[model samples]
Target: MAQLFTPLTLRGITLKNRIVISPMCQYSAEDGFTNDWHLVHLGSRAVGGAALILLEATAVSAEGRITPDDLGIWKDEHVPGLRRITDFLKAHGAVAGIQLAHAGRKASHSSPWKGGAVVPASEGGWTTVSPSAVPFTENEPAPHELTLAEIQQIIEDFRVATRLSLEAGFQVIELHGAHGYLLHEFFSPLSNRRTDQYGGSFENRVRLLLEVTEVTRAEWPTELPLIVRISATDWTEGGWTPAESVQLAKLLKDRGVDLIDCSTGGNVPAAQIPVGPGYQVQFAEQVKREASIPTGAVGLITDARQAEDIIASGQADVVLLARESLRDPYFPLHAAFELGVDVAWPPQYERAKPRRR
Candidate 1:
C-alpha cells in the first residue's frame, strides 16, 4: 500500500491521506477580504481530493501583509468569506487549515505579477515592522523596530486571529514562521539583532515565536491541530540552522504544536541554496526524529513515488506541495491512481475517474 494514501492523525484531526495542499498566496484580496477568486482557487483543490487544504499565509493584522493583495484574517469580518471556503472544503472531504502570518519588514510589497517590489505609500504600501530596524535587502527601506508593547499587541492579534479561525471553521492552524517573515525575523540572527528579551541568545530570539504560540494555543481549541511552519535553515553561515530547528521543534511540540512543516531558506538574500527535488526533506526528517514529533516535508516534492517514499520510509508524516499543487490541484487524485489507491472522486467527476489498466 502507498503510505502516502494512509491516514495520519494530528491531535484530534485525522488527515484522510498524507498529501497536504501547502498554502499558496493568491494575492487577490482587497482590505483583507476573500472573494470568489479565493473560492474557486481553494474550492477546486478540495474538489480534486486533497486530504488537507491549507489557506495561504493569512496576515494576523492588516499591516502584517507581505503584499496589499495577500489574504488577511485580521478582522472579525474576514470570517464569513473564510467560512464559505472552509464549508466548501469540508463538504468535499478535505480538511481546511489556515496559516496565520506577519510579514514584518517584508511587508508593503506589490504582488508577484506586479514585479513583487516594494511599493511606496502613495501606491498603497505602508511602513513595515520588524524585531530590528533592518531591511530585508540593503536597497529596501528599513522597517520600524517593534517596541516591547508593540510585540505584546501582536501576540494579542494572533490570539484574536485564532478565535476568528475557529469561527471560520478551520480545523488546523499553521503559524507562518518561515519565508523570512515576521516570526522568522525574530529567530534568524541574520535579521534580528535585539539585545532585549526578544533577541540575541537563541532562547531569546525564539522567545517571540514561543510566546505567540503559547497565546494562540490557549485561544485555539484543544480538539484541533496547531502546526508551525519554520524555515529550518537560512542556508547561510551563522544563520538559523537545522540543529536549531530540531531544538525549536522540540520546544514547540511541548507547547502543543502538533507538527512542523519543514522548509528552508528565505531569511538571507545573499545565502546560496541548493534547491532541487526533495531538497529540504532532510530538515523535516531531522525534526521528526530528533524532536520526536510529526512533521510535514515540503519543497520540490512533486511526484507520487517521491511522496510515498517519504512517508513509507518514515521520513515525514506528511508531504506538502505548493507549486505542484498549483500546476495540478488534482495531484492527490492522480497520485492515488499512480499508487494504486482507491480514493473517491467528487460525484460530479466520478464518470471521469481513471480505470485500472
Candidate 2:
C-alpha cells in the first residue's frame, strides 16, 4: 500500500488514511446555520473515501464571522443543523471535524466574490475587535483593541464552542490559529501590537493561543483529537518565523494538541511568498523534526505520487488537500486507483469503482 493510503491514529481516532480534506471556507450559510449545501458539499467528500473531512472555518460568534454568510456555532440552536452534516459524514466512513475561527481585525468583510472589501456598520457589519486597534490594512478602519475582559470573553467563547462541537457530533476540532484569523492575529507580532500581557515577548505573544488551547482541551473530550492549523511563517522579515512555529508546536503538544497543520503566509498582504507545489512542505518537515510532533503538510499538494512521497519520506504524518479537493471531491478514490491500493468504495458507488489492470 502507498504510505498515503495507510491508517493514521491520533488519540482515539484512527483515520483510515493520511488524506485529510482541509477546511475551506464555503461562505454559504444563513445566520450561522448549516443547510443542504453543506451536507452535500462535505458529504460528497466523505463518500469519495477521504478518511477525515474537516468542515470550513466556523465562526464562534456573530461578530467573528468574516462575512454574513460564514457558518457559525455560537449558539445551541446551531447544533442540530451541524449534527445533520456530521451524521452524514460518519455514515460515509469519514471522521467529521470543524475548524473554530474568529476573523478579528479581518472581520466585517464582504465575501471574496463580493470584492472582499470591508463592510461598514451601516451595511449590517458590526465593529471588529483585535488584540490591538490595528486594521489589517491601512485602507481599512482600525478595529477596537480588546480589553482584558474582552480577551477573557474570547477565551470563554472558544470554551463554549468546543462544547457545542461535541454536541454537534464532531470527532475532531481544528482551531483556526492560522490564515491571519483572530487567533493568528494574537500570535503574529505584525498583527498583535498589544502592550499588555498578551504581547511584546515571544511568551506574551503566544499567551492567548496557549490559553485558548488549554481551555479548549479542557472542554473537548480526552479521547478525541485536537488540531491547530498555523501559518508557520509570515514570509517576511522580522515576522513570525519557522523557529517560533516549532516552539509553538512543542507547547501545543504539551497541552494535548494532536497535530499541527502547517500552512504559511496569510498575516501580511504585501509579504512575498514563493508559491509552488510543496512549497510549504518544508515547514511541516521542520516542525515535525524539531518539535517531535505529528504535522500535516498542506499547500498545493495535488497528486497521488507527490502525496505518497511526502508521507513515504517521513516529511509529514498526513497530507491535507484544499483546492485540489474542491476540484475533485473523490481525489482520495482516484488516488487509491492511481496508487494501485484497493481501498473500499462505498456500496452505492461500487459499480463505478475502477478495476486495476
Candidate 3:
C-alpha cells in the first residue's frame, strides 16, 4: 500500500488514510448556524473517500467570525445543525473534525467574493479585538486591545466551544492558531507588541495559545485527537520563525496536542512568501524532526504522488488538501486509483469504481 493509503491512528481515532480535507471557509452560514451548504460541502468530501474532513474555521464567538457568514459554535443552539453534518460524515466513513477559530483583528471583514473589505458597525459588523491595538494593516482601523478580563472571556469561549463540538459529535478538534487570527496574533511578534504576561518574551507571547490549548484539552475528550494549525514562519524579519514553531510544537505536544498542521505566512500582510507546490512541506518536515511530534503538511499539495511522497518520506503524518480538494472532492478515490491502492468506495458508488486493466 502507498504510505498515504495506510491507516494513521492518533489516540482513539484511526484515520482510514492519510488524506485530510483541510478546513476551507465556505462563508455560507447565517448567524453562525450551519445550514444545508455546510452539510453538502463537508458531506461530499466524506463521500469522496478522504479519511478526515475538517470543517472550516468555526468561530467560538460571534465577534470572532472572520466574516458574518462564517460558521460558529459559540452557542448551544449551533450543536444540532453541526451534529447533522457530523452524522453524515461518519456514515460515509470519514472522521469528522472542526477548526475552532477566533479571527481577532481580522474579524469583521467581508467574505472574499464580497471584496474582502472590513464591514463597519452600520453594516452589521462588530468591533474586532486582539492582544494589542495593532491593525492588520495600516490602512485598516486599529482593533480594540483586549483587557485582561476580556482575554479570560475569550478563553472561556474556546472552552465552551470545545464542549459544543463534543455535543456535535465531532471526532477531532483543531484549533486555528495560525493565519493571522486571534491566537496567531498573540504569538507572532509583529502582531503582538504587548508588555503584559500575554506578550513580549517568547514564553509570554505564547501564553494565550498555551492557555487556550490547556482549556481546550481539558474540555475535549482524551480519546479524541486535538490538532493545532500554525504558520511555521511569518517569512519576514523579526516575525514568527520555524524555530519558534518547533519550540511551540514541543510545548503543544506536552499539552496533549496530537498534531501540528503546518502552514505558513498568514500573520504578516506584506511578508514575501514564496508560494509554490509543496512549499510549506519543509516546515512540517522540520517540526516533525525537531519537535518529534506528528504534523500535517498543507499548502499547494495538489497531486497524488506529491501527497504520497510527503508521508512516504516521513515529512508529515498526513497531507491536508484545500484547493485541490475543492477542485476534486473525490481526490482520495482518484488518488487510490493512481497509486494502485485499492480502497473501498462508498457502496452507492461501487458500480463506478475503476478496475485495473
Lowest summed lDDT across 10 adjacent residues in model 2 is found at: 348-357
Residue 286's lDDT within candidate 3 is 100
Q: Which ten residues in a row have the lowest lDDT in candidate 1?
A: 1-10
Deviation (Å) of 159 in candidate 3: 0.3
Model 2: per-residue Cα lDDT over 1-357, one tens digit each:
799999999999999999999999898998999999999999999998899999999999999999998999999999999999999999989999999999898988989998889988898888999988888889999999999999999999999999999999999999999988889888899988888999999999999999999999999999999999999999989889999999999999999999999999888789999999999999999999999999999999999999999999999999999999999999999999999999889898899999966
Task: State the C-alpha lDDT per candidate.
Answer: 0.94, 0.94, 0.96
RMSD, one per candidate, in order: 0.7, 0.7, 0.6
* Model 3 ranges with Cα > 4 A deviation: none
In terms of lDDT, the best-performing candidate is 3
The pairs that clash in candidate 2 are none
The digit string of per-residue lDDT tens for model 3 on 1-357 reads 899999999999999999999999999999999999899999999999999999999999999999999999999999999999999999999999999999999999999999999999999988999989999998999999999999999999999999999999999999999999999999999999899999899999999999999999999988999999999999999999999999999999999999999999888789999999999999999999999999999999999999999999999999999999999999999999999999888899999999999
Candidate 3's C-alpha lDDT? Answer: 0.96
Shift of residue 209 alpha carbon in model 2, Å: 0.3
**Regions of model 2 farther than 4 Å from truth:** none
Residue-level lDDT tens digits of model 1 in 6-92: 898887899999999999999999999999999999999999888999999999999999999999988889999999999999999
Pick out the ten consecutive residues of candidate 3 with the lowest summed lDDT.
Answer: 265-274
